[model samples]
Target: MESTKDYRQLPNSSDHYCFGCSPLNPSGLQMNFFADQNTVISNVTIPDHLCGWSNIAHGGVLTTILDEIMSWAALHFIKRITMTRSMNIEFIKPVYIRNPLKAEGKVLEITGKHDAVMEGILYNDKGVACAKSTARFAIFSPKVAKRFGIADDNSLNFFANVFGIK
Candidate 1:
């Protein structure tokens, strides 16, 4: 388990988030990720209420976990805030709702300005690969940040803290 100091303690992104990554929304997944050296890892225990069919975890939920991890990994390595431009995922096996899952992501390659390719994997309690994902992210610039109505200084500071950037 990570201490609060080791985690990214920051405000939520927006008010309405059906996506699993946002922490502000009560119904969201509220998944938190931390940087471990060069990789980002998160442990999640699926709740019975979030199961899709029977006792299996929902596919959509699995995708969200992969997406979030990949995006965070990119931000950590690139030292910039970014948004996913494209993502592809493959579900290898069914994830059980009662079991704990571990997700990890790393930067594969950094393309020109604000562009990066990241890869991530999800493993079951037994360490089996349950799912995998790859994503392309575009880093947000000051101009883009203002256009999106996102707080530039606060958001950049959040990533800087995670990446240990000055």
Candidate 2:
């Protein structure tokens, strides 16, 4: 297991205006995750502004959280940066905007050289599974990483620092 201190620390790039995990995005989810053994766990509070129906969180918003958590699980646990190739989600119950949600993800399997299968679940404050997702991720290459503005050396170091690889 990686050091707990390293797992708990957010990468410097985590603040890079990301809609899901950026702390600087006021309109973003600002989600924070913790490494749990080989998985990643996070709690998300749905705001009223993110609702699709009266007092209920939007399905799209929930999907984004699941995607983010699953991607992070792949990167942190599988030791690779990746982009989602496809994701399938299942909505089991309505997510209330007034309650916090628990999101957890783990790497299910590696299917190919650059592809992985990952799974995630979202649970309401009452611990009921409200949603779940599975996704395929394609490993990021230098070219694709550069196109996303994520290939900077400083950014790589930031990730390494957070993951305790250095």
Candidate 3:
């Protein structure tokens, strides 16, 4: 069964302007995600402006999407702020512009107290894997993220509310 619980974006007061998941950025991807058990999924359609060659989605944009989803996966499952330490992507087929696509992410393993490995896959409208990614993420607690200047107070508050952190 599919999960109906959607991940909420940071409030405007957080000044969130991520190119991948921020809803307030006019030129951003504005992707939204939901959780299915331990997996995070986003359904998106690449706009014409992000195309690379003719109708194909840009490789950089595809990479960003994969990174974003995997980051979210690590955040949601590991309950921490996540940064991509390293990543690898494999493009199996072209993702065409102006077409429905699905991106899915899941935590493959938590290697240590603060490190995780996650995988993301982008699927075309036909449910074929168009791109695949595996990433190592560095995870930090909310307080650690705030102390390290990775996230401001408002952003940390938003995450605390959503993830039930104190």
Query: After superposing candidate 1, which stretches have Cα over 4 Å from the reference?
Result: 1-24, 150-153, 161-166
Off by over 4 Å in 3: 1-14
Give the C-alpha miss distance for residue 63 in model 2, angstroms.
Answer: 0.4
lDDT of all predictions: 0.76, 0.81, 0.84
Structural RMSD, model 3: 2.9
| Residues 80-132 of candidate 2: C-alpha lDDT, one tens digit per residue | 66889999999999998868788889999999878999999998877889999
RMSD of each: 3.7, 3.9, 2.9
Cα lDDT tens digits for candidate 3, 53-149: 9988999999999998898777677878889999999999988989988899999999998899999999888889999999999988878888889
Kindly indicate the candidate among 1 and 2 with the higher lDDT: 2
Error of 2 at 165 (Å): 7.0
Error of 2 at 86 (Å): 0.1
Tens digits of per-residue lDDT for model 1 on 1-166?
Answer: 2243555532335544646666676666677677756787777777787899999999988988898888767766777667889999999999998787888889988898878999999999888999999998887765576578754576556545546433
Candidate 2: give the clashing pairs: none
Clashing pairs in 3: none
**Model 2 Cα RMSD, 1 decimal:** 3.9
Model 1 poorest ten-residue lDDT run: 1-10
